[model samples]
Target: MNERIEDKVHFTQYISVPSPTSSGRSAAWLAKNWHLLNHLVELEATTLSVSARIEESIRGRMLNVVVHLCNVEDDTDFTELVLLSLSSELVKIQSISADYIEREVRCNLRGRRVTSDENDEILKEIMDALEKRGVRIDYS
Candidate 1:
């Protein structure tokens, strides 16, 4: 079967989910809300990742977060914008600080480049769908 054009569009955002009291609770929250992340991935109608990692705080507690984004292409500008959009979606996040980085990788096929706002709109739609599911993440 021929692949759909929309399937070529893909993006990701690495968000540092704020520490929420306990690491267990934060983990639980992520587990329960995985659908939100999945829906966000579906927004682009392509593959996406919003994975997380936990770091030890000064207090020895873990700060749970998904700290990296992996898109098919190395479009740093577009990736950064998608992350900002995610922060806006999860209003509970008070702040987001990410060091933008870019890497080149060999790909089998060429892809069209997309604008930042267009990427944001896809993420917005994903967040909206999650909201209707009682996820209530703000994508303002």
Candidate 2:
């Protein structure tokens, strides 16, 4: 038998609190704010632009994005990561276990061109949504 090696990238996960994680509530928030899509944002150097959208999927939906890394220089990027629906069993898991929790709803983690902003706008949006529901989250 051969041991399988997983291909991974350098990234972080969302860790929330209050005893058992309320992944269901968190996922609901994501679906509610999903309409914040179809946007064009430029990179720091003004040399790139990112186009993000939400596309329908069988498993739920995915964050579809594309980046013209060059603006004229190179081209690049969106990301996926399922956002398990509220009705799904995975959504009931705790938030701290990044791997165990149902990621049916998650922000784009793949940092392709790397935004120029000091803080990620998408993450901020998510945080705001959770705040409304009285859910506190920390990314680690």
Candidate 3:
């Protein structure tokens, strides 16, 4: 069967890292650190500015780090390096995962759509880093 493949476009992904109760750090505190943000920029992982927003839910204050990847191709590498850099800061990382929207678009009979999968290598590295620090990773 002959089929045409559609090019996949990379969208913005959101990664949430919950604050640790023991660390006594608030979302604002972490956001102001700027160490991780600066490091990522230096490595050229992302040209997009990194912003940390604090959300107040029933669970309390949550730190959500938004990483804007300049190139979708660098998603995996960017994520891996960010997590690693954050680890060295002794920041308590609760979970690391991407938030993206999935939509279905109509295609011609000869066209097929392909989407990018989560960066497994980076995910694994983040998992290991979290585990070593006794932090929990959000796989869900």
Candidate 4:
């Protein structure tokens, strides 16, 4: 597989999760809605984290997230995007604020790179899928 760290695409988007939760609740919400994290791409290890912010006031809509995307690369190259995180990548995402989000979105581009428009489209699809799951996270 192509494992070039420099080749991966990395981007961050501030999003708002409508659940509006407090400490413990965020993780609980994430755990409960585990199936919704990556509705577009079902990757367990890649999407299992919700940072618990303990402060004077328990607020919602403050989710510091990291989302990594990967594509299906087979001989046929079907029309499917599978969410996957290698163990190494998992370690990095966990140590950071955005748990499980790394700069590792696998793709077979023959030689070039993923354009901005393409990236936007993919993100929109992901956000849309998440919205359908009752979790509205803006990708602005």
Cα lDDT, model 3, residue 24: 50
Better of 1 and 3 by lDDT: 1
lDDT of each: 0.38, 0.34, 0.34, 0.35
Candidate 1 lDDT for residue 23 = 88
For candidate 3, the per-residue lDDT at 15 reads 34
Clashes of each: 2, 9, 0, 2
lDDT of 3 by residue, 83-121 (tens): 222332233533433221011111110131112232333
- Residue 48, model 4: lDDT of 18
Which model, 1 or 2, shows the larger TM-score? 2
User: Any runs in candidate 3 off by more than 4 Å, and if so which?
Assistant: 1-80, 83-118
What TM-score do all the candidates reach, one by one? 0.22, 0.25, 0.22, 0.25
Structure candidate 3, residue pairs in collision: none
Q: For model 1, how does the per-residue alpha-carbon lDDT over 5-46 read when each residue is reduced to its tens digit? A: 223434444444537778897798688868866766556543
Best TM-score goes to which candidate? 4
Off by over 4 Å in 1: 1-46, 75-140
Cα lDDT of model 2 by residue, 1-140, tens digit: 22222222322233232233667875775566444321212212333333323233456432222211234344433233322222222222433232322142233334544453412443344344333433333456
> Where does candidate 2 stray beyond 4 Å?
1-44, 47-88, 96-111, 116-119, 129-140
Give me the displacement of residue 15 in model 1, in angstroms.
Answer: 35
Model 3 / residue 118 / CA error / Å: 8.5
Residue pairs clashing, model 2: 65-78, 67-77, 70-73, 70-74, 82-104, 83-104, 83-105, 84-104, 84-105
Q: Count backbone clashes in candidate 3.
A: 0
